[model samples]
Target: MNVTTGLFYVFSAVLLFAAFRVITARNPVHAALYLVLTFFQAAMIWMLLKAEFLSITLVLVYVGAVMVLFLFVVMMMDINVENLRVGFWKHFPLAAIVGVVIALEMAAVLMGGFRVVDDPNAVAAAAEANNAKELGKLLFTQYLVQLEVAAAILLVAMIAAIALTLRARKDSKYVSPGDQVRVRSADRMTVVKMDATQAAVAPVAEVSEPKA
Candidate 1:
């Protein structure tokens, strides 16, 4: 009906399309990029909804940092596309049904439940005044448990990534920085100062050759 409504629909369409492509896309890199697009669209929608703190945070953290790292890893990894697609046929029906059910549920929950308000924010600087401080307070107070859960999830992801990339090679050596930092040259090398005194006592031996 108005600009906000129009923008909402546009952002919604982009988010939906990108989310769909995230699962359906064959390339892992493409999937990551689609996911980035989805995050961006959601950020925009959130901004329109006056959730500037969350919107900016989503852009800065997820789209900027996390997704960039994901894209880098996906692009560098040796992912087998053909092998990945092998079970696509077998999984498609279940996946599609699950996707449709989720979509329907979300639609049912959102469609008639939303009420548009006439509040256009009392002050333009109100969001800026409260942005980071409010978010930090809320995150550290009300949503602390959620924040911890997210951290735990990220830690698990990091562990999974490490496990995926871990390899042992017979020819290669690995050392921890902490271990290296604690090591001393005396532990690794022998230093003999017996130098000059030992040198003076050593005499040249006469060489003897045997007939071949």
Candidate 2:
């Protein structure tokens, strides 16, 4: 096989392994780490396919930001693995069925006999400008509303996740922004004034110098 094909196979193998580990790992942190590896491999594959914009975005956004956030959240959260695994066996059959269905769907897609044919005209057109620039222009002009909607949905999902993971402990202290904004100096501190009296001082005891 050619070098490109060999590297593709290698990346694909690692990607599959990392993806499998992401699902099967017992620890959430480990799963997140594996997911990061999966993202990296996918990004590399994209790079190989000359999709530099998507590859860089996948690395920067997902691997750098999202996966890091996932790792931190997974690490910080108190996840009871034993409790979570309690019903795994009970749901195994359903999970297996779903997995099989997905596998069959993928197989159908693979069997569709898709081929990539390089068009010289398209390549010549693309050579005039960078793909990222073209993609940006298209997204901003043609898909602006869809893009904004997607961003809004992502924002909502982020807020929901934060709300869900938030735990209110009895000992936990929370400061309200509204209360802070409304706070007055009188509420936080007391200013007391005392009158000063004339001092009657006779406390100093003077000692005579000892004879050398």
True-structure RMSD, every candidate: 7.9, 4.9
Candidate 1 lDDT over 1-212, as tens digits, reads 99999999999999999998988898898898899999999999999988888899899999889988888888888988988889887998998999799989999999988766556674555645766688799999999999999999999999999998898888998888999999998899997775554445667899999999
Computed on alpha carbons, the lDDT of every model, listed in order, comes to: 0.88, 0.89
Residue 70, candidate 1: how far off, in angstroms? 1.8
Q: What TM-score against the true fold does each predicted structure earn?
A: 0.62, 0.70
TM-score, prediction 1 = 0.62
Total clashes, candidate 2?
A: 0
Superposition error at 189 for model 2 (Å): 9.2
lDDT of 2 by residue, 1-212 (tens): 99889889999999999988876788888888899999999999988877899999999999899888888887888999878768777887898799899999999998887666499887687667677988999999999999999999999999999999998989988999999999998899988898768767779899999998
Most accurate candidate by TM-score: 2
